[model samples]
Target: MRTSSLTGVTPVLTGSYTPDSGGDGPGIAALRLDPTTGHLSYDEVEPLPVSGASFLAAHPSLAVVYSTNETEAGTVSAVTRADDGTLSPLGDPMSSGGANPCHLTVHPGGEWLLTANYGSDTAPGTVAVHRLGADGGLLEPTDLVVHQGSGPVAGRQEGSHAHQVLVDPAGRFVLATDLGADAVFTYRLDTRTGTLERVAVNPMRAGSGPRHLAFSPDGDLVFSADELSSTVTCHRYDAATGVLTALSSVPATTAEDVANQPGGIVASPCGRFVWVTNRGADTVAAFRLAGNTLEPLGEVPAGGAWPRGLALVDGHLLVANQHSGSLAVLRVLDDGSLAQPHPPISAPSVVCALAL
Candidate 1:
């Protein structure tokens, strides 16, 4: 094991685009986080080479990271980070069993990795499961679950598009947000075998386009960011049976006239608030959370264009702006309001930010 101090600099791994890239950029870049000011600075290290590293997830207990190469022939790669914060490839990339794999997350037990494959024009969306080696290297996918059906919208929902896969806090179930299907699918995980068994398909309003979801700290509530309709939906979560009942749905953007696409949703650490990122409006909307309900707290400028990813680090809210090629740092005030601390930092086509 490598021993390192957490005093001066915190390592941050960012997935970005390359020069001649089509989908965003090319590789995964390294960054340093100032623990004091919550500011980020590029580390000037050579990024780990990948085709279209869009979304990233770190192993819970290892110095390894996984990323989805969002392309027609989707692949997931494993990279190990050295003690000095440099990254190197761990193994050859593995096919994600579908096209345009966009998001991935390591299981809470660190024994499996799950990916959401946003299918291409010719293929249907799927969710793939891969076993993890003892050291966190990704093994070949063990199972691929193809989603059927589509939403009400035309052109956008011609087929299923699974966007994200997340394991519930209790580890009893895995939930996937299908943007094209307009629903959240729940699965009972066979932990020992590293496979998934479909338990439920919770449907949302047609055309809601549920892209990403976040669960409350208590695991009693779940919130989804609806991409097509620019709405946020709160659901009552039943951890025992993995059922989600829609409680309320509200517009993600305060302004009615502005066209907005909601990208990411995250609940506060304390479970007092929920935050969602708006792409077209370039704002982050905050909501006060009550028992199975949400009251709009307001929205603030994202400090950059096209906020694609939002992560909570320490006590700060980090927004990865895809179009602006920067990451904005905002302080999470005590009352759950956001306050911009420093100007946005440079990061080209940043889609995911993982703090270590």
Candidate 2:
């Protein structure tokens, strides 16, 4: 057990994962963090006992939580978080309508949740929308949209694959990435009715395979990770019309060799720097933002293999290395570099982290 360095407030962090045992037994884990010393201790690992859950989103206001089960018959689970960080299962899960629902988005107001279903060849892909009730549970399916397209990658882009879903800061639009289809679809969101209408569909580079997206604090630019090509694409975002125009693409891979490819991306709260993870390469790349352009700052060893997910909490960078089963901790310096890494703690196939 680690001693708590918390002074006035207790800090809790939540994580999600799929166990090696192959049953409807996916689980959510909770741990406590010492704010001053950055020490983390195991708190509770709740047994959700649901099938195929791979990602989770915590409500910003309510104590409710949402997770997606990626499968042919994908489902989203709703749960309630207690004051101590323990979770209780909420209402019955909702179907995603397509296959392999891997990513989810919660509206800024915490009133709606959306899922991106990366459908298989037979199933096709879909975006499932749901109403988040006052208590944080899902009310019902409000709308669902199917995707269609093919890209240069013969096998991977043979069909639509809705990779991620994210709502814009203004909460007026929802953006969905389709890796297989090589497109980012923007939809006008009806917050009151929980509906989405196709606003614009922007086609990416032939085989870029856009995976995940992050919006700048000012909501002027959007950054997306292109998994297959190992690049990060920038776009000028128009909040009023729900449109995105390509600005530039930054190469995530250096000359020597590329690692696990780019995955999650996050812009610093202050909007000074952007951080992206390279899984196979075991590294994290930092970029300095000048207006709308991205200048590579430097790359640092992530301290483990396959850093799939990352979180910036209290100025520290926490990396969730999925394959290595470790959490890499680093201090972000003023110049957008890393301090010497603190020893990482072993975690169970951590795919995502939510600081509470």
Candidate 3:
């Protein structure tokens, strides 16, 4: 698809990842989202020359956006958003020194930022911890840790791949999902020094491939999405020890068909429902939560293919469909199903969506 010159709105800033296909880096885009209509229109799009920018994480104060490059020479770029939504380079990008940095998290106090490096075909995956400057930039890496383990599935478990790293709502714990290891490694947050010391490590089922995790509003329960098994596991969280106990494993996918498995899992801000993406099935699964149990409420046809990332914004849910190259806006029904707000909006290789 040809790149479209963005027009028609005043964007507050442009965000882009480093990985663009065909030797072309992804475009840093300025966006204007209409709250009333749930419409997103682009204002500007500038090419980011950096390669492999996969995830863009905004700072706590919204002063900057950081991009992770899932490449051999792992790097993170700090970018400032202008009044017009055009991104300005902050300073020299820092090398993660690991490989394939997939996800990043900013400290609640805005003092530290962490990256989960997924590694590559030749490199073993690891986690890189860095401090954040007051001006919203990544401090040079002072600490890095490598993860090692293999899952039951030989094809998928050749080596460790750190899939995601998330901070608890209270900023007390940091969780990393190691796909190859089939484990969720937990750590205690040290804001003063920007370091991660192992608090606990919880193993998921043999071949579950724990991919990503999200916490409930109260921080009492944790939900992890298992990419390979197509299941979402619920765990009772121990805030003091950072230990997670299995409560129940819910099938995000339906039947034995691999097509029904989900890619992402997140709870509604109201804590009434949970959302997961069934990538191969091209649907978004919504479920109602009652204590520790979850009841399925049918699937929402994401209006696109391969729905990857979803965010609950205000009263609507925004979904980025990776294969259809589009973004969709949907409203949660009282019964927990999702309905389209309008036609699916277009974006090239859309992977994640974050509401500011």
- Best TM-score among the predictions, by candidate number: 1
Clashing pairs in 2: 259-280, 259-281, 260-280, 260-281
Per-residue alpha-carbon lDDT of candidate 2 for residues 1-356, written as tens digits (9 for 90 to 100): 11223343344443445553232223566666555666666665564555555677778777776888766668888877666555678988888767888889788878888999999887777898988877888888999999999888877888899989998888778899999888999998787788889999988888899999888898989888899888988889899977888898888746365444798898887777888888777788888888678889878888687887777777777887777777777778898876655788777666666666
Better of 1 and 3 by TM-score: 1
Report the C-alpha lDDT of model 1 over 1-356, residue by residue, as the tens digit. Answer: 22233467777878876553474554898877776688788776688878788888988889888999888878999998887777899889999989989999988989999999999777999999999999888886788999987988888898999999999988889999898988899998797888899999999889999999998888989999999998898999999889999999888988667788999888987889988899998988888987667888878888899998898877878898899888888777788877763699878788878887
Please identify model 1 stretches exceeding 4 Å from their true place: 1-8, 19-26
lDDT of 2: 0.77
Per-model TM against the reference: 0.96, 0.91, 0.90
Kindly provide the TM-score of model 2 when superposed on the true structure, using C-alpha atoms: 0.91
Q: Score residue 198 of candidate 1 by CA lDDT.
A: 97
Please provide the root mean square deviation of candidate 2 (C-alpha atoms, Å). Answer: 3.2
Model 3 pairs in collision: 12-85, 13-85, 17-53, 18-51, 18-52, 18-53, 19-52, 19-53, 262-277
Q: In terms of lDDT, which candidate is strongest?
A: 1
Distance from true position, residue 96, model 1, in Å?
0.6
lDDT of 3 by residue, 199-263 (tens): 88898898998888888898888888888888888888888778888898888856455555477
Which ten-residue region of model 2 has the weakest summed lDDT?
1-10
**Which regions of candidate 3 deviate over 4 angstroms?**
1-25, 45-50, 255-261
Tell me which residue pairs clash in candidate 1. Answer: 17-25, 17-26, 18-25, 18-26
Instruction: For candidate 1, give the lDDT of residue 34.
Output: 76
